[model samples]
Structures are given as C-alpha cells and as structure tokens.
Target: MPYFSICGVPNCPNFAHAVFVANYLSEKLPNFFYKKIEKIPREWAVFLDELNRENKWYTHESPVIWKELYQWGGTKYLIGGLSEFWEHVYCYYGLESLIPKYALDELALDNLRFFADKRRSEARKVKNVAILGAGQLNSAILIQDLLEIKTLRKGGVHLVFKLYDHHQNIDRSVFQHLNDTALHFNSTSFFGDFNLVELYSSAEDAMADSDIILNLDDYNPKDADFGKHMNRCTIRMKMLADHLLVAAKRDAKIIFAGSGPLCYMATALSKACSEMFPNIVVITADKGFPFVTAASEETGIEIHRISAPVVWGSIGVNCFVDIRNAFFKADVYRPYRCSLTAPKGSTLPLGVVSSELRLMGYKIKDAGVIERKVKNNTKKMEDLIGRASLFSKLRAIGLLLKLWYADEVGDEIISLGVRSNGSFHVPKGMFFSQPVKLSESRVWVPYSNYPLKEKQTKKRIKQCILHAKDVFGNLGIMYDPDDGFDEDWDDYSKYLGEIGEGEEEEMYE
Candidate 1:
C-alpha cells in the first residue's frame, strides 16, 4: 500500500487528525495506508530531568507530568492554551466530516470516468501518490475524504503509504483497530504499497524517487509544558522540513495539512523549495482557536480555510481570506494583544491558559525563567569601570565588558529599574526574564534611568551581582579580572558614566 503519515509530539492534538485520516483512507481505498511516528519515551524523560533543574521545578517522579509542566509554562502560555491546540485537530476533523461519505464515492466514480477518457485519448502515466501524517486519529477521516477524491479523479493516481515514527512502541490497539477497520471496508481503487519506517529518515529515502511530498508534522512539544514544548518539537521538525525542501528543490509539488503553527513552519520550508517547486499550497482550518490564531499572527503567516469536503474531493471551494484581510487590512505585522478587531483590528482571544494561570496564582511575570548570567555580567562591567587602569590593554578589555553588560544585561538592568518604579507597581512575586534591548531613545521617559528606592541603576546592577555571589559563592569578577571577564572593562566606564545618576520613577502607561 502507498503511505501517508502524521507526525506530532507526544500528546499532540493533531494526532487525532492523523489517526482519523489513515484509517478512513485505508478502509475506503485498498492500496493506501497510514502510519505514525513514535519516539523513545525514556530519552524524553532524561531530557526532562536536565531541563527541570535549569527551570528549578525539581520533580523526581512522573516525567510525563514534568514535560507537560514545561510546555504549559513556556510558549504554550505565550500563545494561548491547550484548548486552542486541540481546536486545530478538531476543525480539521470536523471540516473533513462535512464531506458526505457517499458524495466522495460519487466523486471517485467521476474521477474514474475522467481518467478512463484521458487514458483512451493518451496513454496515462502511473501517478505514485502518497499522503503524509496518517498516524493521528483525524488522519483516518482525512483518508476517507481523500479516497472519495480519488474516485472523483477517476482512480488514476496510485498511492504508497509512509507511516514514520521514531519510537517502535505504537499502542498496538490503535494499529489493530485501524487495520481491522480498513480490512472490513476493502475498496480496490487505490494503487501502490504501504510501509512504516522511522520518520524523516524514511521520508527522505521515500522522497528520493517520489514526485510529491505531503507534510503533516506540526506543534510537537516534547515533555515540556505547553509554554516551552514547541522549542524541542521544532528541532526534529527542521529535519523533516529540510527533506521536503530537498524534494521541492528537485521540483516536487507539496501539499501540507494542519493549523496555523504548521503554516508558520511551512513558510521557511517552502521558501527553501520556492525556487524549485512552482506551486505550494497550505490547507488549514482555524476554528478561531486563540492559541493557533495568536501564533498565526506572531509568525506573520496566513492560513486559508476551505470546506473540508472540497479538499477531500480535491476541488477548490469558497476559501479563507488571508488573516490580515479578514482582520487588520493594514499594519499586518502588528503585535497581537488584548487591544487589537476585524476589518480594522481583532481583539486577542482570551484563553484558558492565561486565565487559569491567573486563577492558579501564576503571574504573567513568572512566565519565563530568569537567566543568572545578567548578574555576573553586570559585576564585570562595574569592576572594569571602577578600575583606573592606564595600560592600553587593560582599558581595551574594560570597554568590551561594559558593552557586553549593556547588551546582555538589559533584562537585569530593566528589572532593577522596574523594581525602583515602586513596590506598588511591579510588586513582589513578579519577576523579569528574557532580556531584550531597546533601540529607541526617549527624552521624556516614563521613569528615570535609575534603580528603585532612589538607588543608581548601576549600583543596583552591581548589588545584584554581589547578592548572587554571596548566594552562589564567589564567582571571582573583582578577585580575578582577567579570568572573570573576557575583555578590558576600564575603558567601557566612559560610556557607562554617561548613563549618569538619577532618581528612578514610576514605570506605567
């Protein structure tokens, strides 16, 4: 049987789509098969343990829970929540179901008729077709829809199944359930064979002599909370993307499925294939899920929603307009927040994650892990500035320290500034992380460039470094300048001095 696959991280909502389409296609068409990718769960567990320490979560049992914790804490919150993730799977499935079962059979019959006429007119070429990402449950439904499409297309397209997973352990019941269901329906129109191999590797080998690469990998967060899960998932996804890019570079037509996140990933992959492949189509069904929707905006990607049945029959129907057209017509790249509406702007979808975080006593400020590097870097700069080194080499080294501190320690500096903004504003329990530099200069700033409680920002920066040293043990910046910093911090003092001493003020809009 020819193969189609669905690839996703553990507990992926999109997995439902894979399972649905695989079984549906297999049952409706004899030559088609769907397979999924699985990974070694233990390896994931080890990785989780390592990350837990860095996060300071420190849970010894239940790697599954720990992984989920990481994801929920990381990017998942930044976007929306798990429900939004599930909506992607649901919308794709729901839309697919809208295609009447018999309607697809009729379409298949039409395709047979069309191919018959064409074959008689000119010898028909054998089309080796495959659908990727077929392991998820929804994939079974997607498969059924594709079979109806085949009948309408006249059964000319042959298929080969590619079910790829990293792990050998697929819940046997799921496979048995699908195999049994497929065997029962037993339609004889599909062409090709089925083989389940390790993902990406198998996909790469299969694409070596193939004409089309159907991609279905998206939103895979390995063992982390939803918030940080996508980070690891994207690493493996990049490999599959590279393979698709190679095929596209070789002029292969690509059809992709899934939600907004997948669409975002596709932009980079498609660009790689852009020069080689003439047409690239991404089919997504956004059910107005907040997370995927916000992610769509954040990534600067567009998803086109078409009637599911039309896609199954391979017929184009009323399709979705680009998100910008549907909402913000201009300022398309504007950041998504609570304040944005449609035609002109759309309000950000308030989701359960953020709401739940608030309910569970999680503050938005606690969303990220604070890096320790900021404190260390700040001290190196302070020491270099205080040192009156006349030696050119020592002065040169000091200059580099201040630049590094300013750039890398921006978050540390900001945290100090915000703390000075007042105990009432930022308050306790709120922490700053993920330092980013500000490029714009403001003559009339909201707050003075000083630390809270009338302290100099530089002094605060220096004090934080000293506190860290006392807590974590002496890191030896002032003790050993050469070993402490990479460069001369003395000369950098001239630049740091310009920041000046001033009273810190409130930092609110």
Candidate 2:
C-alpha cells in the first residue's frame, strides 16, 4: 500500500490546521490511511544528544526538502491551512493531472459517508483454499475458518488449505493443528517449506485440490543475527512460485496475508507465480486499522473492508475468517491488468539501485500503494528480476527529476519533478517500454511520465537552449551522469547537424 506522511510543528497554526484536515481525510477516504507522529521539540534535541545511541538524530530529522515541501505544498489548498502538508502529495504525484476530480470529490467526508452506508456485500464463492505461513496465531485462526468453510462445501468447489512457512518448528505445530482440524472436517490441508521439491508438491496439490491459497506468512522482519526474515520469505516464495507454475492447471486464486508494512515478499512471490501461471488469482489485505482488502485485479487481488485501527485488534483477526467465506462466492477478485509493469527487452541486474527503483514504481502502480519492492533475484531469473527492479528505479527517478528541475525549469519544459516518495499510488499513469537505442553501448529512453515523441522534442529543445546559454555565458557546470544536464552533447551536435543538413538545399541538386 502507498504510504503518505504529513509533517509540521504540532503547535504551529499551519501545522494544527493541516492535522485537522488530515484527520478528517483519513476518516473520509476509503483507500487512504494515516500515520500521525507528534512533533519532537527542538529543546528535546539537547536531550536526544545526551542519549546519543548512534546519534539517532539522522533518523528523527525529516529529509531536507520534505520540511520545505510541507510548508509550500499543503498550505495553499487545505482547509484553513490544515492540509498544507498535503501540497507535497499533489505536487509530487502530479495528482491533479492523474486523479480525476470526481475521484477526489468522492474521497470527501460526505462522499465517503454515502459509499460506506450503501449495501456492501462480502465474497462468498471461494471453496478450495491454500493457507501459507504456519504462525500459531495466524494458523489457528485459518484452521477454524476452513472448518467453517468445509460446512459450506457441498462439492461446489473443492477446498485445499495449503500451508507454507520457513520455520521448521512452526511447521510441526501447524501440522498438529491441521491434523486436529482434519479429524473434525472433510477438508484437505497441506504444509511445506522453501524446498523447491516440497514446494512443488504442495503447490501442485493445492492447484489440483484447492481454489484459493491463503498466505499468512510473518511479514515482520527478523533480527539480523537470526537471518533476514524477509529474505527467507522471498526464498520460500520463489520456491513456491516455481512449484505453483508446474502444479496449477487452470484458474487458481492465491491470496496473501499481507505483511504489516506491505512487504514485497508476497508481491514478488505473487508476481512471479502470475507470470508463469497467468491463470491464478492473487489478493492481499492490509493488517492495519480500517483494514482494507485488495483482491488482485491482475493477480485478482482487491483491497476491501477499510476497518479502523480498533477493528484491527479483533475484526481484523476475523477478517481472515470472513475472507474464506467471501472467497467462495465473490466475483470481486479481478486479475491485476498491468500493475507489475516490467521493463521491455532489458534484463535488470538484481539488487542494483537503479533497477530496484523501477520495480518499486511498477509495484506501486500495480497495488496503488507506496510499498517497496522485494529484493529477490537469481542468476536464472536475472532478466525478469532486472525488469522489476528497473521499473522501480524509473518511478523514483521520475519523481526526483520532476522536483529537482521544477523551479528553474517550468513544468511545460521541465521533464523531471521530485516529490514526496510517500505519496504515490497504483495503476501507474506512466507507461514502460523498451528504449530506442542511439548506439551499441548507449540507449536513450524517456522517463515514466514523458511519452517518447514528447521526450524527444523536449530533449532537443532543452539541449539547444542549454548549449545556446552555455556559449553565451561561461556556465561551466561539470558533466556528471548524476545530473540530467551532463549528457554527452557530442551526440546532440551530431543529431542537430543531421537535422540542419536535412533542412538545407542539396548542393548536388
């Protein structure tokens, strides 16, 4: 899910008003969530300095631009400056251009109330289910739900509750729960780990024996000493994905128990599985308050049920149970059409910062959230993984470039504008495509927001103006790849010469 942050000094008139609007908006928007942190007093800085555990100052201080942005972005449009901090959201996302005015209006307090009060229904058609992760709390609730679902099954849909996890200890306990539950019901439940062979068996069995796989993996990060829990989860998912591809025959619904922070483990695992087994469905639910349910439109995940924080304590627990019943009968589950947009004809190097940025963008656009992409790739999956990573980097770059050049360059001509990273949502307005190469080693492609033709025109115009200004003045800016201005203009000169000659009368004629 995309995260949004609102910031300012708590007592400041501008800050207080923004908070009021933020609180109201959080209450209003079905898709939007909020995390409010109280301001840290400047006087407390001395106290913080005294404690000095790695000088956590860096952690508490907001980014340099974010503070300035909070002042500029949110103030103009908010109610009594209450939403002043949100201006960053509008600017960063280019939201005015992307989000329809109607949609924004729908998020208003009155509009949300109308939608919330309407006759809402839960999904009830799902039968066969696979439950991943064998955590005691999650598994216990999952088993109970399956038992209830079994009573609904009169052979309409065969149910398979396939359980997966990385903890060997938890596996044993999960099996005991499954066995105990099996004695009471006629449903089939299976368990496995990261082992490819085992994963293949479990996934194949589920595809044949089940309809929906309820993944309840622990999204919590494990201690470094114990090993990265997320990495373990990804490894398990990769193995599970390979097995799912070989095992699932036709349409299968794969639902994930979303992590606390929308970990990419589930997204990556679901994405990989979807790529190979395009027929399967994937859905994820938020674990926070106003718990939203998203059944994959592409992977067949949709965000449903935006319950409040208090509801998360109990109702959220029951949401897993509710989903099983809803799964059997709901048509709300739609496959994600193009959320995980991969780079065309390019193999992204895994763990590379550039590629990761692209993957993040793709995932955000897909899920409609500002969640990070999972870092998992191997020698064999390098190409696909590269595409994922590069997509993420591109999205980040688009936002950065937009903000970096926003003031000096007007929006009409400036291509890159940087905004708050937290404000992005899904079904990316941006398109991903292959680059038009200019040389064997060098290729030129437009960023996410710019179309090819527009980019080409802008690039030429910008280059011409830049060179003209450079020749007129001694603007000796160093050429560096980091800044967009530092391009190999030799290519530009050649390109310009070709155009210039094309326009001139031919001497031979």
Candidate 3:
C-alpha cells in the first residue's frame, strides 16, 4: 500500500459504516456491515505519518509515470513478483517489519508468488467515483460511507463523487451525521486535499472523467405500470449510456447495477425452455434432480409462497401474522412462463415448472412429480439456516465494491453467482447467474460442468440474451451486446493510415 501511495495511484479505504437508518429498514439492510469498529491498527497510523514526508506522492502524474517506466523494463526488481520488489525495499528503506516477509529459497519464493498473486490489485489511479440514482437512500448510504468512514488499506485514496439523480431534493442528513462524526474521528483516514462531491442534473454532466460509476436506478420497473415505465426508463437509460460512453474516461469501470432480477429470470427461463416440445414429462432442475412439467398449455405459475407461520412456527413474531397472507416467495415456485409481479420472489422455480420432459424411462414422468417435495426440502433448509430478501442484490453490491477497490485477502477465496462479462465459455449479456471465483473480473467456468462450447449452454445463453434484447430494446435500450456505434471501433488512426498519399495509385495498380 505504501508503495502504491508513493507511486501516485489512488487507493480505496475498506471502510465499514455504522447503520443508524432505524429498525424499520433493518429487514432490507443487514446488521453485519453495521457493527462499529473497535480498534484502528497502530501500524497503519505510523505508515500514514511516514507517507506524509514523501513529496513524490503529493504530486499525481510523476508517480504513475515512474510506475509505467518501471513496468516497461525500467526496474528489474518490480518487473518480477511483489516479493522481489519488497526485498530491495527492505534493504534500501529498512522497512523490514512493515512489508510482508519474502522467501529465501527459490522454490519457496515461486510457490509464495503463485499462492499470493499480487497482480490482482494492479489497476492504476481511480480518484473519481460516481453514483446514478443518487437520490435513493441506499445510494446515499453508500455515498455517505465514503465521506464519513475511512478504513486503512494499501493505498489511501481521495474520492470525488459526481452524483446524478432525478430527485434533486436529496436528504443530506447523512452528510450532516458524517460531518459531526468527522470531528470526533481520531484517525486521519477520511478525505484528502482533493475530495469533492458534485451534483449533476444530466448524465452528460455526470459521467465525464469518472473512474467508477455505480448505476442504481431500476426506472420504477417494480411498479404496477412497469411496461410503460420500462419504455420510458429504457429510452432514458440508452441516452444516459450514450452520454456515459462518450463522457466516461478511458478504462473506466461502469458497474451497471440496474435490474439484476431481470437477468436472473431470463437465464432461468432459458434453461427451463431449452430444447423440447411442450409435453408433460421429465425435466432436470438440479444435478440429476428431475422435475416441473406443465399439465396444460396454461399452467398457473406463482412465486412459491408459504405462510409465515409455516416458516417461523413461533407466535411471537409479528411478521408471521401479517395480512399479506404469505411472504415474498423468491426462493421457490412452480416452473412455467407466467405474469411477473413486483414484491414477489424469483422466476427460476417457475421456469422449472413450465418446461417439458427431458429423458423418460418407464413411467418416469409420473415419478417426476417432486415439485412439492423439493419446495418442502428448500423450506426446511431455509428454516434451519434462515433466509433474507434481496440477498443476491446485496451480494452483488458487495462484489462491486470489492472489485472496484481491487481487494486482496489471504489464501481464502469466495465465489459469487453473478452475470458473466461474455468471457471464456459464457456468452455476452447472459441473464442467468453463473458461479464465479470473486476477485477483479476473474471468471472461472468449470470444465467438468460445462464443456467448451457446450451446445445446451450456448443455446440457453443465446435465447436469454435475445429475449432481453427484444424486451429492453423496445424501450430504446440495447439490453444485450451489439456492435452498433461502438466507441472501441472509432479509430482516428484509420483515417490517417487507410487513405494515405499513395492509396489511389496502389488501388489503380
């Protein structure tokens, strides 16, 4: 981190905020991230003081330029692994205890380099972070966290936010709380000389030169008149994206956090609908777990709902007695194509219900009536372990933060079910979530589960993307990847080289 700081790269603090947003919204916002910090690491404070003495860090481009020079074979030590660089630092700077110990043996060093790969956090200088739909409380909470809390990490960063929102009457109470707390803060972790929060009325104004953009708006997609809403929102999103593409700085990471549920549903639906005629027979949901055949053309598809009492089994809990009859059934359901409603759970289970049989043995379809049994099993698991709404959404947000910050943990690894970036085996704009080993854009598709260019996977991914494109494109948005007006295609060098001085003569010859 001190090395990155000295090199002029901006670093994000891994700050955790105390949630004072009241208990009413506690159901949506979990308590895990809310806990207060007990102690600040003493070593980090000493490091900060040492960093303050360096003039190279205060100036921006020099450190970055120096780094680029090093990467381009300027420094032999740094060109190798982190340990090699640190070994020299230990001798030269005498900061032996400050840095992680390097290996003495060649084989040991090689193994350590492979195990603790430091290349994961290699992105340079992200100073500007923007949030779309900045009016929302959740958005504000994220922003407020940046302003107020500062966690000690490798490279300390100064953040500037360009917030864009339709609702201008933003509740700035969060900032007030941060400001009040900033005075009481013992550690000099929050903010640098360059910190600023700028508000923008338009996307064009907001996106320019932003290193990271967090888009949080759903355009009221969960509303009753969502079809009309989608049309309006989609147009707005397209225009917004156009502005963003043109305005956002080169190599900017745009965390497109808009409507993940749609992607999840489309993927699930595609899976259920893959390769078959509509007949009541066998189908597979999980590994060798066969089920969900529709009895008729129109089968009632509902988000799986169970009475709250059935889940809790305790009379003391008020939520168990709510008049809504049943909780939001996101986890399970009858698999089929049906009307989508807001506040309901997921469509994956319904996708399972609607699809026809796969392979059938002697009366296997009759034996495949395990929908009720599966739901019961799932419910039991949930009861034992407990379940929460918006778990996927929250997880996605956490992932975005980790990626944005380029977080480095120890040997421990975490996996997330996220939308694929059209990398490796996954097709572009895959709506369904795939299990990926979490860390800066490192997507792993198991060769055993999915063979390279597996026909079924390819077909399903294609189907999902097409449906999303149709639905989202109707509202003037390209929901899936397309080559239309690609910014990457625009090359000024082409005009210079394509029609050169001798181009006409060469053509004639």
- Most accurate candidate by TM-score: 3
Give the per-residue lDDT of model 3 (tens digit) for 1-509: 11111221122111110011111223454431111111224444444445445422332121111122223323311212233434544564454433122322333344335323543333333377777666443554465555543431336555667777655545466444434333333233345433356666676677788766666554334566656655554455446546655676645555545442333332332233323211110000021111222211112223222211111100100101111111123333354545354337754343543333111111123322443444465577568866512233434455435543554532222222234454333334343233233333433221122111222223343344445445545544334345432332234223334545333234324
Query: TM-scores across all candidates?
Result: 0.29, 0.29, 0.36
Where does the lowest 10-residue lDDT sum fall in candidate 2?
A: 308-317
Model 1 scores a TM of 0.29
Which tens-of-lDDT digit does each residue in 48-90 have in candidate 2?
3442353232323321112312333342221112333456546
Tens-digit lDDT track of model 1 for 338-397: 433333444544323321100101111221111123234335755987732123222222
* Residue runs of model 1 more than 4 Å from their true location after superposition: 1-124, 150-155, 159-170, 174-201, 205-212, 218-234, 245-249, 271-275, 286-509
lDDT of each: 0.33, 0.34, 0.36
Better of 1 and 3 by TM-score: 3
Q: List where candidate 3 sits over 4 angstroms from the true fold.
A: 1-126, 144-153, 169-192, 222-227, 258-395, 407-432, 437-509
How much lDDT does candidate 2 score? Answer: 0.34
- lDDT value, residue 381 of candidate 2: 43
